[model samples]
Target chain A: MGHLILRVTIKILFAPIILFAFYVQFHGDYGPGGGFQAGVILASAFILHALGFGLATCQKVIPPNWLPAGMALGVLIYAGTGIYTMLFGDNFLDYDVIQPDSHHHAGQHIGIIAVEIGVGLAVACTMLQIFYAFAGREPEPMDDAW
Target chain B: MMLAAAASAEVGSEVTPSTPEVVGFTGAFAVELCLLALLAATAVAMIRMRRLFGVAMLSGIYSLLSAAFFVALDAVDVAFTEAAVGAGMSTVLLLSGIALTAKVEMPVSRTRTIAPLIIVGVTAAALVYATIDMPGFGDANAPANAYVGRAYIEQTPSDIEVPNVVTAVLASYRGFDTFGETVVVFTAGLACLLLLGAGAIRGGGRNDDGEH
Candidate 1:
């Protein structure tokens, strides 16, 4: 069937992109890869899936109502890290001061990863949501003046 | 502080520095130049094309080529955003708009062609002139790296504790800019929602019957 072939092709194309995204996120310290690039790559993979499959299928995967919540959650996670630092008797986003007794270096790395994950989540979800919104809807008519 | 530590380590390294193999730089340069030429050619083609859909697709290619240029410059974040927004989102929106209006592009007139050509020529000349006195590409010790970037590398870790300098700069030192960017994203979402909501309502009213 047409749907089966499409699904197989989609999986083939998407698997590598997802793997590469994880590589970019983790290997950013060594080279030119980072959270943003990883996020976009992941988002593009999903957008491609949405394009190939029907918009209804895409909606089932990422419902419109869930998208706003995801975006807010991502922003909150990022802001929450800063708030944690602030509450621990330091300036906002001062990860070194997170835990005075523990090794500060470990804490800093944890904090950076947390924030990067938040950014990645926000960007990926927002991009997919935008594509869904645009592609799922039909167009309006032109003005009657003509 | 990390950069300084790295720099100090570099000073005492026993290994001799050598250019890492980056494929064929000449071939890469030739390909990049060809892409740039293709971008320009496509822009002209888009203008001359009689079909609006073709123009939109050509413009999308132009955006993608610019994104490739950004990647070649090692600006991955910018390239990501451009590929998503400019190439992906804008093209979709433009096509949707065209679907709502006329499907064909308006015929080009001599008056329109002359103005755009002159504008493009003047802009290109200015850019060429500006690049003449610029430092060579990828110069590590260029003014950009020496001054503006140096401060962030030196001070941010001690203060913000983020190993990634770009993240530290965007989220902490330049937090206001990030805030502004968030607002821009929110505003765009709001505008799209409003516009799309109106369209949906009108579409529904027109199609009260279940039949297409």
Candidate 2:
């Protein structure tokens, strides 16, 4: 009964929080935020969910198996972009040549976005993975104690 | 200082108001000082608090204050990261830790506390002394602003086409460093997973150290 309000509030908030994370993620090239901040923002949303809904419930939604795998996948995406640039006979991570005939760093735009997304995924999942390791080991504490 | 920022922003709206005014530090140094004072007070309170839970909360407040301080210095990106990671995520993580452990910190002996306090005081005094010689905020003639930092600010648009120079530098100019940092973060997470085992992966649930 005590959790009814928290559950409702989080339910209301969950979507917007995720949306804002992506906003921060993509908006970095133009604004004051980027992947690290956005990733933490995204992870906090889930962490908040885990707080309200209980670890087991949250784990069921996200699945613990995806955490470590997702972490490595993000790193791969980031490094893969770098490696892809290298394959094109360009210096590593030199975005200018990634798209041969593009005008004025169009390739750079593509590269930064891809790399940022990779960073976002890696950071978000790593944070969640760490949270699961910490929060998963124990049952929910007594509601009043919190 | 915040009051002045708000007032000036209002005045700015009255003029060429197409764009909102940047939160400038031109006349807001006092606000930064006040924020730093609040941060110091919060840190002191955190130390004095016996309950680990209370300390965690105070530390979160300290993070928030410092985030505001960062904003006053025109480091919006840093402030954003600090607010999210320091104030938001770390606070929640600390609480999760407290839930797993004891809420109250163990009381230390009076005599034992004195030695650490003296060490902390001396270190802080030294840091303060060092700060006295450091360049003032936004000092263009300072080494950073005068040299490579200025070059980055000048070259970013031409080199990367990113409006946010920090992002341009981080993802492009400093691409190798950012890649290394990502790898480092990935490695640390892997190490943690190896040691602790992701909750469900190890034991089924609570008290699931497996051997038990």
Candidate 3:
């Protein structure tokens, strides 16, 4: 029989973990979090799900095929922001000219948020992808064979 | 930067002709010491343990203690990162790796162990010597505090206008550095995928056993 209690517990806990990750992602400007922490937090929920259920079950939720896209997209989003700033005649990743003729704070704020989103996506996907890789491998005989 | 300015103002108000009271063996210090002791114990236990499973758990405990210590030091961001990466990701990864190999640690010859011990001893001594020249804790006159730190604190409001100085410094002032770090993280992930992702990433069956 499945560990029904553990399964139920995971089911109940999943949404809140994702919610908390979003809160950390956005609240980073005021508090002690950022894209890095948020992304890890987000991916960890899936890991937890994998533990409670199984890898195959978790893969159904977040397909292994899409993980590569998630990983690359994050970098693209981040570098794209820098490239956008350059197009505006500003230094690479410079937020001052992101929203030209607008409030500098607004520009800076938007730039930070965008960059953080990119970071969050990259981190979350990479972590989950790594988990998939490690978990998918079948056990092998040790070299000593003791 | 408002938060940062308030902090600077608070620090300014505390400065007086009288010398500031030195923090002694307060409760926080006691907590810090306890965490440090636990961390050291965990590390030693992890090293000594023959069971790789227990070693992985102990390492996770070490990371947890380090995160607690960071929180005590008011570096909540660092603590958050430590808890996420070390406790969350690394422990899981290590356990997965252990599943693919022997649970018991391979016995090494005593002679082979001596080289690592001497290396660690020499490195620890050098680190202790390095700490001797460092400024005392909370020393406002410290080079990092007296100049660049203050400039960031004061100018953040006028420049990027983010309230969290750490965020402002990381995201705006040294944004290019953060960009590079993101790319590094991406590169590491790509490398891992390249190495271990064949079975998982390919369309159908995985592993030598051909489990899909």
Question: What are the TM-scores, per candidate, against the unseen true structure?
Answer: 0.72, 0.87, 0.89
DockQ of each: 0.26, 0.58, 0.68
- Per-residue lDDT of A8-59 in model 3, one digit per residue for the tens? 9989999999999999999988888999999999999999899889888888
lDDT of 1 by residue, A1-146 (tens): 12888878987987897888787776654445555566667777776676577656656666666665666676677778878888888877666666566544656666666666666666666665565556646555546535
* Candidate number with greatest lDDT: 3
Across residues B1-212, which tens digit of lDDT does each residue of candidate 1 receive?
A: 12222322232121112112334667666665675666656666765677888878876887787788667656776776677667876786677567557777556667766765665556555555655556555666869878878898898667656566776676556654654454455445545545555322222222223445
Question: What is the full ranking by TM-score, best candidate first?
Answer: 3, 2, 1
- Candidate 1 is graded, for docking, as acceptable
Per-residue lDDT value at A70 in model 1: 65
Report lDDT (Cα) of residue A20, candidate 3: 97
Note the residue pairs that clash in candidate 2. Answer: none
Off-target runs (Cα >4 Å) in candidate 3 are A143-146, B1-22, B203-205, B208-212
Q: Which runs of model 1 end up more than 4 angstroms from their true locations?
A: A1-7, A26-30, A100-104, A142-146, B1-28, B74-101, B116-119, B151-176, B198-212
How far residue B149's Cα lies from its native spot in candidate 2, in Å, is 1.1
- Give the DockQ of candidate 3: 0.68
User: What is candidate 1's DockQ?
Assistant: 0.26
RMSD of each: 9.7, 7.8, 7.8
C-alpha lDDT of residue B85 in model 3: 95
